[model samples]
Target: MWNLARVAWNLRQSRRLSFAIPPSISATQIDPSFFKRGLPFTTCKGFSTLETQESGGLIPSELLTKKTVLRPDRDIGQYADLVTRVTNFHGEDKGFMVLAGDVFDVPIRKDIIHRVVRWQLAKRQQGTHSTKTISEVSGTGRKPYRQKGTGRARHGTLRGPQFRHGAIMHGPKPRSHAIKLQKKVRRLGLKIALSARTAEGKLIVFEDLALPSHKTKNIVNYVTQMENTKKVLLVDGGPIDDKLKLATRNLHYVNVLPSIGLNVYSILLHDVLVMTQDAVNRIVERMHTPINR
Candidate 1:
């Protein structure tokens, strides 16, 4: 009887001990709401909260904290009254202002720009590629064999596509790849290019490109001091000065073009645009003129 009583007491103590120990949490015991909040009180070992969020098909909150900020576009009306300061060849302030409204007020048109660039690139192509046709080939016009005699396939001439050294079939021929765009469209594209440069603060206006000597070192030293980058395009109102041309010719990154030569392609290609005040006036006037057709 005593043994039975002791066994009952032992069993009760074992039951108490089992209840005192906490139950281990299994994967199924986790609340689904914790996942919806993107965090859980208990996480698996060797994993982080961010990793948990990522594994749940959600972007990590920390990654989305930093964002790309863009500058606000300048007002069109403000450009009309805009006056840019002019600097001299020696980088000294000339204390003169040039009206930049007409050139800087234009809104950027990406589609028109793309079309103009494509057109300019197309016009530059020489299109000199040539291929001879059957008529141009050296082979005689006579047929290779009779209509149908042997088991071999019939051929009209040796110049046909099958024969070696024969004329090419549907090959490229010499022709112009030039593409024409409307004058107004071209003008607008130029304005937009200028405006883009202005907005980006890459346009520089100078009194003139006139230099004392034709030495390359003079212009190179001047440009190196004034420009932040080596890629610069100089625009002059009239014919480029002989000294300036010679000075800039040796430098691959520097280009000199008359105002008339100013196009979207050259403008966009350069990192900096340095133009004379007269050149700026010419561009504004050109943009103001109405296209004939």
Candidate 2:
């Protein structure tokens, strides 16, 4: 009877202690949203409350339509579409694409371009030609004959302009022969050149040319693959990309020039013309400037 009473007392104490103990649970098993009363944000236009972007942010449509894709109509006599919408890599407005054909081939006077090119060449010849004067020639300073004393004709110093190895008499000398053409003429000439190229189907409009690190060989190879020609001049529409510049510098026949650096001469020098769409836009903007011929 004594042992039974002690056992009952111990069992009762154990039951009381078990009831006071807390339930066992894992921290990972707990629901993270248990602390929230309800959804914190309201719904937006077609997007969830949590997915709403900041106010005044650019729409996805604007971001996608920023760059204007130009589809050149080769069948339409090399005409290209002018796209005036573009965004930079940072999604900022970078301007639009103007078709090369429209800018370069706008009915420009051929004579103006020819005159400008001729004048440019002539200007380069200035100070190049030099003729020796009588005083500068190396020869005898003393008179060869007396002045009209004898029956023979009077003879002067050996270094006279009349004699061989003598100073030239009113001959061609170094002089400035700058040809003056009007500003309108110079502008027209550029337009004519552009027009001629477009008419001849020499102009090319390429998609974006994303360059890698500065590697000329790689660039040259890519260009060669793109256009199966050995002689090519690449015009970058934007700033001079160092990687593209350095890659083509060492190549003998390949010329890579920035769009701003391009002119009629360089464009005509190459057999093939490859311009990025961006470069085409830059060229058109440059034509709008009034140039003095």
Candidate 3:
């Protein structure tokens, strides 16, 4: 009798222990590397260790570290100044200028640049394209012939799909093609473009873009001094001066814009970016401003 009771008690204890553990961890073997990476470890109810916990597959190699580890701006002490020569309109070196590393040293990303350029182009489109439909077409509504009497194919209105000069079917209409992109993404794209120019050694800083006169000939002389650059973009801190704008108006290869008007598309269009000292300060301040959600 004593032996039989002892056996029954052992069986009940085993069942209780089995029911205590949930199915998720009952047979799961934890990945050893999970703890090495400093990831949080949890085994509470409703919490899962991994997607393939049942089979105990090793953690993906990508999950070993943070994704932003490769970016150059990861360290606070690494924000080195980008020193470049500041020249006057006559192409004479005036002094040296220090540019913010955060803005001009960003890593280049082609996908983001492409996306922002596309977004800017799409937003600026006129969206005026249109086509007339069957009801709107100018034509007689009467059928061409009876439905079954003629041996030729029966016809409806002259503006039908099969007839010449007919209305277009399911054609494109006037609409917006602008896609929604995050403000952070737009800002980042601009930074990347600037960085790319810097990386290519094409960034030029000017002490001042103030032209002595609005004569196109004088501007041409100044441009020729800069190694005969083909495309030039001149940027000022605030509203462009009347003299400068008028002087460059005739030069199709030269464009002038205020710092506020700067954009990624414009930056990439030109071979060189010329900016005043004041413009660089304004740009750096603008980039550092906090963005609100």
Q: Best by lDDT, which number?
A: 3
- Misplaced by over 4 Å in model 3 are 1-79
What's the lDDT for all of these models? 0.78, 0.62, 0.80
Top TM-score hit = 1
| Candidate 2 error regions (>4 Å) | 1-102, 108-112, 147-153, 199-201, 206-210, 226-230, 237-239, 290-293
Native RMSD of candidate 2 (Å)? 31.4
How far does residue 264 in candidate 3 sit from its true spot (Å)? Answer: 1.1
Provide TM-scores for the models. Answer: 0.73, 0.57, 0.70
Per-model RMSD to reference: 16.1, 31.4, 14.3
Model 1 Cα shift for residue 143 (angstroms): 2.5
Question: For residues 1-293, what per-residue lDDT tens digits would candidate 3 score against the true structure?
Answer: 99999999999997985675545554244455545654333343553343333224455432233222222334322345688999987778798988898898887789999999999999999887999889878989998889996798878789986788999999778998788889989999988888888876778898888878898987788677766478889999999999998999999989999999999999999988988999999999999998889
- Per-residue lDDT of model 1, residues 1-293, tens digit only: 99999999999997875564345533344455545774423223532333443345444344232333333455542456466779877878897665667677677789989999999999999999999988999968998888897878888899877899998999999999998888888887888898888877888888998899999998778767754685899999999888888888899988999998999999988999988989998888888887785
Q: Give a tens-digit lDDT track for model 2, residues 84-202.
A: 34432123455555565556546545566668788777666757678888878987789787887589777768887767888888877877888776766666666666666665556
RMSD of 1: 16.1
Q: After superposition, which runs of candidate 1 have C-alpha atoms over 4 Å from their true positions?
A: 1-79, 226-228
- Candidate 3 accuracy as lDDT: 0.80
